[model samples]
Target: MNNKLIRQAQEALIVLGYLSGTADGKFDKSTQDAVLRFRRAEGLKRTNIISQPLMPYFEAATLKKLQTNLKTLGYANGVTGKLDKATIAAIKTYQKNNKLRQSGEYSHVLLAKTNRAAREREQARNRRAPVSVQNNIGTSSRSNDVVISSRNIPSQSNSSKASAMPNLNNRTVQENEIMRSEPNTAIQGKMRILKGSNGQVTGCKISTITISSDWCTSGNNKEGSQCNVLYKNGRVLSVRCR
Candidate 1:
């Protein structure tokens, strides 16, 4: 099988919203989540393998998701899902980070970043051992490692928003963007703050990364987004939110 072709196919899934993770091309747990969600949404058997039968729908969805994210990050000037220069640039920047690749090609790094983006989200759920969640965390600015602690949940004394660290990526704050709070159910002294683009926790500045399980989340035009998390299944893959 042509790994390049397979990687391209996987990139289609990431761009179109069929999957949310690194486009690393290895098709790890996060990719599985996106596929299952797409399959379940399409009334097909949810399988791990991306086969020939499901290629068309997968491609369409991947393009859409890619367009959305690229646009959100100010990369895709075009609304269409076509891989224009703008979109490629956005993917390249993303590739440089979360996926952590030196090559410019859309090899495994892109696939991995798009797919594994949600894997780091477990930090929002698990409070006891914050390091547990960072194990598979990506290197994206937003993928900044979070350590959910029972003590860090939003409170009058700490909910000052500024009390939560600032997003040092120099990313302009969306004026209307509401800062989300970590769950109040955290245990005492458990670190429960979101990481920033600086790779440090300023205050619990919860960005969209807290929305899903990080790279574990997957999206598709048709099925929306899904996760690879074991959840109750004894697995730990997560999914991105749409």
Candidate 2:
């Protein structure tokens, strides 16, 4: 088979969450492992060898995996391989939820965001660990109970809104206060509060929030105007409120 086909298969495996490394057209160990995982997930024979018939399966599997991820992120998109209205609508809904543009187009960036959301949700659910017999003696049973919240349940919000996070690579923020609490580990770089057309902080970006040690020249970064406020500790957020 052509190396291009292998690269395509690699990209599909990536969309299905079976691969992590880049699709460099080389059938390396990571690519082989991803192929094995994809085959297992699709109920095919567990092998690293790519075949002609399996080519179509790669694309279908990618779409289905994306649909699964979208569902996990609280969108009710259908799992059809075709670019149906339902899937596009779900993409738009996801974009709106993440304060992104409602282009209704599938991109690797959007896939990444959905994957992160799914992983975060999975982590949150995992935090409610099963109760242990040893701890049952000293404390109330309710204290050890695993309570799952419905905060992540999907909603059918309007996807027509034109809200999006500013390109963080191109923009930066001026800060006002230094955070005292431990920062959210997931949140990194400089955080900026994004404002909507009405001048309200509709969303926020994880852009470079420059921190300076000197009191007199704190806002003197070469990137742009800087803020003296430090945000070492603050609430970790995916986006600000609407």
Candidate 3:
């Protein structure tokens, strides 16, 4: 058995709150018990060995837990199991704040550090007591009086009508042209339109990734009509009707 693999597994288990001892690169009984528990939780066959096939599962589980912790700590906005762009950004921010290397990658060491920080924060919160605020405003016996003077306010109906009219001048047209010339709109315009088997406009297929009608509906395009969607690097940037 590779001691390095065992040590990595132990570190993952520790971050996942399955083990308590140090990861000393030894397949000890404690490590075996932790591995068993993890396996059970993952619904994998009962095994104490950290094989090559099982390593990826451990890494994925550890990453999910780390993402959850970061979300709870306000470092991440969502708990995505994969290391997508948002996850990378969150990891980079967290590393920068903690004075660690901003590699934007996951490792057992990073997971352990994040887990420790979360535990410390939880303990500190538990140690604090709830504070109660008391309102002690005394009643005043002074008479409060107010007087209002009415003044004749002039309203020009011509000015109100002019203000309510829509502006169709050159500046408004220029602003609309500039908005249409944006890079996102240009990209969407350039995307190849896709159709379903029935010849109705369904969605788009950029490279190997497919943006289906469900994604369009999720973006408030409930009709799933002819829509332009901007997608890049496994993320949907924008969705709008053509």
Candidate 4:
């Protein structure tokens, strides 16, 4: 699909709660479901029509429904209920799976994919995992997407090691100046860029992001040796160097 349409579809989905990444205008499954779910609930045909294909017949209500969903999902930050950045990020995550769009817009194909993934995710969650002692080490929720090895880790550490961990509490706060303001703003820690399983943490900008959990590395928006995520306080938390 065209980039603009893809972004529109993705934006519509994020406005609905079915996503968790920046809308970069790629039509993925997450976007697809956003369209379908909104349509079905509104008593409309559950099809991919959040685009030129659907036209005026399903445009207005669909957009409204999408916004409503986004608010319901906590992604819609503003009370205005407009499809903003938060909504777009949440939607972009869904599109990641279907391999469609990611430009933070709304479209047809993305709507379809989004709907399908949600249903599948629900089903999978409901299904019981096979009983086995085999290690199925899932990634950490806190470390963005980088997988750290807790395996064989010594539970007991000397005071020196504990003290070695960087303390972010002393960080210089510059709220008025505003850093990490843009979506896809790179995350950097002591070592490098922090990346999620998908790649790097690319999503909405939060007013406050405390580095409570220590990050040796970080995440960024582009491929580079130098960090893309520069801190106003001169601290590079972590950089997303691909």
State the lDDT of candidate 2 residue by residue for 1-242, as single tens digits.
67988888887777667887788888888988888888888899999998788987876766666676765544542456766887888788778767899999886567767778777766654443221111112222344322222122222234422342223333322222222222323324434444344322222233332111111111121112232333212312222211
RMSD in angstroms, all models?
14.9, 20.0, 20.6, 16.7
**TM-scores for every candidate against the unseen true structure:** 0.30, 0.47, 0.52, 0.28
Across 1-242, the per-residue lDDT of candidate 4 in tens digits comes to 68887776565556445556768876667677666776676677778656676544345544445443333222232232344666577566545544656677755444445445434534533442211111222343443332222233222223334423223344322211113222343544322223356532323222223221122121222222333344423233343333
Q: Clash number for every model?
A: 61, 1, 0, 64
Cα-based lDDT at residue 208, candidate 3: 26
Rank all candidate structures by their lDDT, best first, as comma-separated numbers: 3, 2, 4, 1
Q: Return the clash pairs for model 3, or none.
A: none
> All models: lDDT?
0.41, 0.51, 0.56, 0.42
Comparison by TM-score, 1 against 3, better one: 3
Worst 10 residues of 4 by lDDT: 128-137
| TM-score top scorer | 3
How far out, in Å, is residue 148 in model 3? 34
Q: Which stretches of candidate 3 lie over 4 Å from their true place?
A: 133-242
Q: Model 4 Cα displacement at 12 (Å)?
A: 12
Lowest lDDT 10-mer window, candidate 3?
172-181
What candidate 1 gets wrong by more than 4 Å, as runs, is: 1-53, 66-79, 98-109, 118-242
lDDT of 3 by residue, 1-242 (tens): 79888888887888788999788999889999899999999999998877878888887898888887665455554565899997887788788878899899988788878878777755644443211111111122322211111122222334345433232231211100001112332233323335454333344433222343323322224332455655332224455653
